[model samples]
Target: MNGLRVAVLSFAHEHAASYISLLHDRTDVELLTADPDFATAPADELRGRGFAARHGAAYVETYEEALAWGPDAVVICAENARHRDLVLAAAEVGAHVLCEKPLATRVEDAEAMVAACDAAGVVLMTAYPVRFSPEFATLRALVESGALGVVLGGTGTNNGKLPAGRSWFTDPELSGGGALADHVVHVADLLDALLGEEAVAVRAVTNRIVHGDDPRVRAETGGLVSITYAGGAEVTVDCSWSVPDGAPTWGGLTLQVVGTGGVVEIDPFGAHVGGVVAGGAEQAWLGLGENLDALMLEHFLGCVRTGSTPGPDGRAGLRSLRVVAAAQESVAAGGAVVRLTPSSAR
Candidate 1:
């Protein structure tokens, strides 16, 4: 059987590197990458033609050339605001897409991306690797099996160091609304999957106090988002870039679920070996668990091969984007509650 030809659209997001490295050696995938937008990216950043060469993947100079190569699938790791265009391009060429998270900076753009893929009859999977975590799957099972009855509310934290390496992360025009936009979608999508319901309202408070001294930090550095779901469950997310630079890892995600029966908490990054290096003073942790990104990629490839619909499809991406949009609006309104209509949720 012939392997699938996969093209990576851009390398703006850090995850693009990992995706390429993981897929490059797969016998079932022929890998190609393009990053025309990063032609002049800082040498310190892992992007442009050099990064692709390091991973032993074929590199192209432009999106047009990549799509023209006739790939079976495309992975979009462009900036938050650029997702719509890349997705539209892939859809036009009948290539399935796995778009990076937050989907888009605006609701209208996300909606348009979803609509275009649907019309083109191509699979549009949202790049939400967290959904593939075994820990989260266990939590969902407990909730569904009556082990945790009637989920009341929960708290989730997706804290990470400020992405200083990528200047675009702090630019609202390119990356959307800072921590709120960068972090909220993961937990929101998890909640949506667990409850199988839409968010009814959102209220949020954001501040620029964390990285405020940096002139380049135009977006909020920290935020707390309260989401009310249609199932009458509430989840509060701490979407903040609060992790200091000295941390052993980039960041971590932790969730605590409360229900009438009991409470359960999970730290996906908790299962790791921590120790000081022989010549270094700082401690480092080596993760000893499954790589969620690899699992997600396998799932995506499986869906493409079988012509099955992906879980957390384009609609799921739009749903999570809606939560982030509402959160941003709430922040703009000084923490006022922003309601979402049922029709809009659909």
Candidate 2:
């Protein structure tokens, strides 16, 4: 296989650092990064962390410069609002794109990105690492195999208290929306993956119960959204940054999928590192496995090289974005039902 040249557009997501590490360790990829404020202190901090230069990677000052390297693909890790422009640019260059979730804040922008990629005949995959998790992947396989029979309903949640450190997540305009937008997609994408369908109707309710007093926080910290898919599957998504600092590990994400034969529960929250005591003492918790960024990167590169389509494509992104828009509309309408159609289901 030929080496796949890859570049990162921004480093604000906090996951940007992880992507750097993943790219550096891969022999099949050449990593590059770019930010307009490349010389800024925070950007310098990222550079100093060995992400920008480790293994001969370059940190360019502009996204166009990064693209000038003639990459086969680019990962859009910039803030939510910057996604559409980057995706369009990459697609125009005939490069496949792996953009972070929420694709874009507006549905029209998301649709345009998809259209651009389709016109270029390049892949446009969303960064939904959860769908690639081993357990979750197995669950999807089981569902596809009909081991669980027909799925009736599912529930997904994304909950956590304030970071106790820095938080760029509270800005609604920047991060898109609050808990509903951030958390809803995971469930939405997972349900879409499991059911092999997209959500067509939704009713949502959100609130600013936490982080409201802070002048710096620009979005609500918590809320819930309910959805019904056109495929006859129902899902409820719960999320908040108000879970309390001392809440238990399991309090964060409790994903449940129910089917005719059995059910699956995925508890992805925890704070333990792996270790064991001599006697009957404490056995340290094993954290989540592998680097999802690298895994996703590998899959994307493989697809690009082999001319295959990856999961959570442009249509999936548009569908998820529509759900987010519907949830917001539902919240604005006092939890009224909103309906939409995904291109795939159309």
Candidate 3:
């Protein structure tokens, strides 16, 4: 463990697969160990070992063992509810953390995670790969630079295929509230980064229309959330798992920002090199422009090495968590407008 030792906290999240591979390949990282405690399959466990061994690391069964390896930083791929504890533990060890999205199941937990990291004086960065996306960064610039010309409002959509294999994603205790929780934070944080504002109030509603009466579909798979900011600018987000399995691709997002000058529409995945197929019955979508995850990791590890606080940090995570918490409250209250007050403000 010489230059930038790293550890993976869990294999509970699907992202761990790609993230481990990337870390193993990085020449700058001296060690990369993955604690594969919750790996679902033997194959997955083997894969984690392979990813670790390639970087001269040994598999660790427990998080404590992984920490004992003396990592400079840790990547948390734990469940949403487990985020708070993992963050607290990692920060306690004086390791900077880069955690997955939807920070935690509750706003209080997200707040506590931020406080713990702050108390430890360790960087607490959230994994918001969309912020590093080139197309998204370009759109953010357009919005912030007044190129959009006095923005009126915006319409955002992130309709993606259901996480078919991941049952914990819909579990209320693990993933928070489902569609609204999973999808809201991406665009919410993106807009906050672009506009330097957070929503003051929100009204949201959900429907269990997908999955056809399967009780495993315990969470809402389709939903609409309306967020209003202090400046009266509003955004209606179609944050749902409404995409059918028949879709050729994994689904995508679209953002339309209207302003006095004109409307700026950004489809980060719209520019595809592929063409229509099967008499236009199905179109092959190839929206693989950039590896935003790699870029985000690069930034996080650089901060770990330099001891600099990173962007889209725990505060950003907390703000998005508050917005989702408000949305959930609105849903429970029959789509009533729930006022948003960030936990940090309190």
Every model's TM-score: 0.97, 0.87, 0.90
Per-residue lDDT, model 2, residue 159, is 80
**Candidate 1, 128-237: lDDT as tens digits:** 89889999999999999999999999999999999866888998999987999999999998888888889999999999999899998899999999999988999999
Angstrom error at residue 240, model 2: 1.5
Candidate 3 lDDT, 152-249, residue by residue in tens = 78999988888765677878878887888888898888777876777899999999888648787678988899998877788999988888887767
> Which stretches in model 3 have alpha-carbon errors above 4 Å?
35-57, 275-283, 342-346
Model 3, position 22, has a per-residue lDDT of 85
Prediction RMSDs, each to the true structure: 1.3, 3.7, 3.1
Best by TM-score: 1
Candidate 2: tens digits of C-alpha lDDT, residues 193-258: 777777778988887768778786777677778888776888888878776654433245667889
Q: What is the TM-score ranking, best to worst?
A: 1, 3, 2
lDDT of each: 0.91, 0.76, 0.81
lDDT of 2: 0.76
> How does model 1 score by TM-score?
0.97
Which segments of model 1 are wrong by more than 4 Å? 343-346
